[model samples]
Target chain A: MKVLVIGAAGMVGRKLTAALLAAGQVGGQPIESLMLADIVAPETPAASLPIDTIATDLSEPGSAASLLQARPDLIFHLAAIVSGEAEADFEKGYRINLDGTRHLFEAIRLSAQLYRPRVVFTSSIAVFGEPLPAVIGDSQDHTPLTSYGTQKAICELLLADYSRRGFLDGVGIRLPTIAVRPGKPNKAASGFFSGIIREPLAGMEAILPVDDSVRHWFASPRAAVGFLLHAAQMDTAPLGQRRNLTMPGLSVTVAEQIAALRRVAGPAATQLIRRQPDEVIAKIVAGWPQAFDAQRASALGFRAETSFDEIIRIHIEDELPPVQP
Target chain B: MKVLVIGAAGMVGRKLTAALLAAGQVGGQPIESLMLADIVAPETPAASLPIDTIATDLSEPGSAASLLQARPDLIFHLAAIVSGEAEADFEKGYRINLDGTRHLFEAIRLSAQLYRPRVVFTSSIAVFGEPLPAVIGDSQDHTPLTSYGTQKAICELLLADYSRRGFLDGVGIRLPTIAVRPGKPNKAASGFFSGIIREPLAGMEAILPVDDSVRHWFASPRAAVGFLLHAAQMDTAPLGQRRNLTMPGLSVTVAEQIAALRRVAGPAATQLIRRQPDEVIAKIVAGWPQAFDAQRASALGFRAETSFDEIIRIHIEDELPPVQP
Candidate 1:
């Protein structure tokens, strides 16, 4: 199967690329070739198959069409401006997140009469907002609080419509907030969720923006990649007209996350988390979902780490160097 | 208040225009001027105030900007292609329903730094689709089965986000199917819902394409106009970031409709209804919401007819000549 990975330079994109390369096959079909695309050209990774990387801005009218020229059998669309950036710059957010995704879908629709590639899009839990039930069900309304979330929700609607029309085989997975994100902290309001875990594990002090009582949904990067792969190969017949699925995730409070870190790395790591509160981030996080009854995704064979301890362990095993005896 | 009514030529638009002129004021504000626009110029209404009609297509670049040049104090955005046409033509649907609406919102946002207008947008119950409960709640997930519903759902998201951003004071009302629609029957799949009542009242045969047991939500043209005016003038503080609402409507089965017709206009009017099930329309209607718990709209003072008999009577009062006893 020929595969195309958009936004292949970002952290999750890079990890997904690595996982795809390692798997060598999807749905039992051997990976014949690969194409990686992003605004900045993705780094060339070691692969036995023919691999190509290109820098392309999807917001540009013809860019999506150009990307579809090769007509890869499977397309993983992970490109998006982060939530913070999207909310900060409204036009840029809609231009890239909304228009860019539409361009991609349109390009696919007009690609050819018979070409129906499997398209897996990564949505976000930001699609749900406040006044939410403790355990949000799969059928919860999209009351996105931010422009970024609105863009995602709109795209999810488009994905479903396009899939129903048979223009492409599409599956949109609304990923939970990825915790223990491997890298330096970013400007995303939800960044602290990862920073508090990753920084401490790396023996550095991290600021706790919200109180211990603040709770949010989470999944590790490893689990996210697994979701993308499963979405690509899954039987879409059962999905029918509803192409999007809210991914399964662990629900944990900030206190639970800290407790898990303490259990995994002892008192030193837990002590590294400082109790400096940031109201802006806290208010933003307040609108987010604490948990979800993502029954649809779970029933479709997608799974995530069940506990904060497992999430912490995954972060350590994946990102940190092994401890010497 | 200077008012701009886009799509002022449609049935509901004409009714709203008439109502606006009769009131001569909105929210205790005296009439200043009126501007009506549509793809084809809306017919000039006999109003005492200064009223201008213009031909415009909102999807075209700069059209929305031109419309907002005067910066109307209140805007009624009631333009859209019907569901059947939108379902038939994908590109046209997105262009008019989605991009057109976005263009309008963007125009308002970019009009001036401090200028914000009350934008009353007419959404539709089509935003909700099947796998539905007997009575869908205000927080139902948007699972639009048709391209039309998808477009409406996307616009609702945009409306809320833009409103939250303070670009515009927007309110989206998800109108139930407008029953007893006047004039010749159009090609809309839901047209028969109105045709059965309208044709029978006019002493003509009307086809009932779905089974009598098939239920759906409905409101009258007058009620829809009321909802729009209320949405434009009501205190939006209670809405907060959740700016869109499913307007209240009576839910009734086709059997109830016929029964109401018999009660209102005798068995003669009911006998004009012919039962000829069209599987195509039946399948389409089956995917629609049968009822809704529109608590938010109800609490906000938007009301609709409580019974199908009342609905039929409304059609007779609004469209037919007065009967002398």
Candidate 2:
């Protein structure tokens, strides 16, 4: 089986690529070749198998077709502009997020009639907006409050339609906010959710923008990758016409996150979180879903950390250096 | 206020235009001018107010910008190819339904910074698909099974996002299947819902493709226009981030429809109906929404007929020649 990973330079993308390389095979079929695409060519990782890294901007009209020429059997599309950037620059956001995804789907449809590959698209929980129930159900309407969310929702609809039309076998997984995201903070409005945890864990001061009572959903990077793999290998027959699924995640308040961080790294790490209420970030976070009844995805075997303590532990194990005696 | 009607040639568009002309005002504001646009130029209606009919394909670049040159205060975007056509011709469907609508919205966004038009977009209940509740709520997740439904659902997302961003004041009303639809039967799979009553009323036989137990939601063309007009004039303040609404409609089974036809025009009219189960259409209709909990729309003051008898009377009153005693 051949594999393709778009946006393979991002944090999650890099992690996913490394995991795929380690696995050697997906659903028991050995991966023959791998193609990694991003806005900038990804760093070549140590792998025994044949791998190709290409710098490509998917927003460009012919870019998707160029990537499709390899006809990888399984494609993981994780490309997207963050929420803040998307909201700030409307044209750029739509061009990259909406138009780019459409181009990819259209290219797949126009490819040889017999070429139907499994497409695993990463959607976001941003698809849900304000006036949300405390626990959003799998059947909640998509009333996106931001351009980024809107673009994701549109792509999900297109994925279902294209799949129903026999253009491709597609599954859209709406991932929860990735907690303890590795690396430096970015422009996503949800960045602080990770920043407070990641920065503190790295023994650096981090801004706590929202109130301790502010709650949101989360999943570890490993869990997210697990979701991607499950989606790629799962029986799409159960998905039927509704190809999108909201992955299960832990729901935690800011205070609960702090408690978990303290439990894992002591009060010293918790002290690094400075309570500086940023109204803008607070407002954005307020509209986000606190939890979800991801019954469908859960029923289909997707899993996540049951507690924030487990989440923090997973982060430490995955990203932190081992403590010496 | 100056007004623009995008699909001025269609049945609902024509009726909406006629209603606007007859009223000579909207929301108590005297009509200054009217611009009608379609793929084919609509026939000019006699009116003292200035009106322009332009033939243009909105899918073509710059076409939308040309239409926005007038900067009409109110815009009625009632344009879209019917379901069967959109299902058959995927490219044409996306071009006209999705890209065209986006072009129009983008044009509005790019128009004068201060010139925000009241955009009343006609969406369809087809946005909902199966595994559906017997009575779908306004919050039902959009899992459209068809290309046309997918396009509509995507447009609805775009509409909400644009409205939230303050680019335009938009309202998307998801219209129920228009029953007792005017003129000749078209290829829409839902055409029989009207045909059973329409063709029979005109002394012609009509095909009933599904069982009498089959149930669906509906509204008259006149009611649809009312919904459009109401959507145009209603205070959008209450809508906030969620600008799209599922308009209220009467839900009745085919048996009730036949019974209503019998009550209205006796057994003679009911006998004109022929039962010829069309597997293709039956399957398509089967996936459609049977009813809706359009409480939000109703609370917002949009109204529809309560009974099929009333719906049949509406068709007789609006489309048929006056009865000569």
lDDT of 1 by residue, B1-325 (tens): 8999999989889999999999999999987999999989999988789999999999999999999988899999999998888988999999999999999999999889999999999988888888899999988899998899999999999999999999999999999999889899887888999999899899999998999999999998889999998987899999989999999999999999899989999999989999999999999788889999999989989999899888888889989999999
Q: What C-alpha lDDT, on a 0 to 100 scale, does residue A238 get in candidate 2? A: 93
Model 2 spans > 4 angstroms off: none
Write down the TM-score for model 1.
0.98
Over A1-325, each residue of candidate 2 has an lDDT whose tens digit, in order, gives 9999999999899999999999999999999999999999999999999999999999997999999998999999999988878988999999999889999999999989899999999999989998999999989999888899999999999999999999999999999999889889876778888888899889899988889999999999999999999999999999988899999999999899999989888999999999998899888788899999899999999999999999888888999899897
Q: Summarize candidate 1's per-residue lDDT along A151-209 as a digit string, tens digits.
A: 99999999999999999999999999998899898787888899988998888999998
* DockQ of each model vs. true complex: 0.94, 0.93
Query: Candidate 1: deviation at residue A245, Å?
Result: 0.6
Quote each prediction's TM-score. Answer: 0.98, 0.98
Q: What is the TM-score of chain B in candidate 2?
A: 0.98
- Clashes per prediction? 0, 0
Q: What are the chain A TM-scores of the candidates, in order?
A: 0.98, 0.98
Local accuracy of candidate 2 as per-residue lDDT tens digits, B143-189: 88778889999999998988888889999999999999988987778
Cα RMSD over interface residues, candidate 1: 0.5
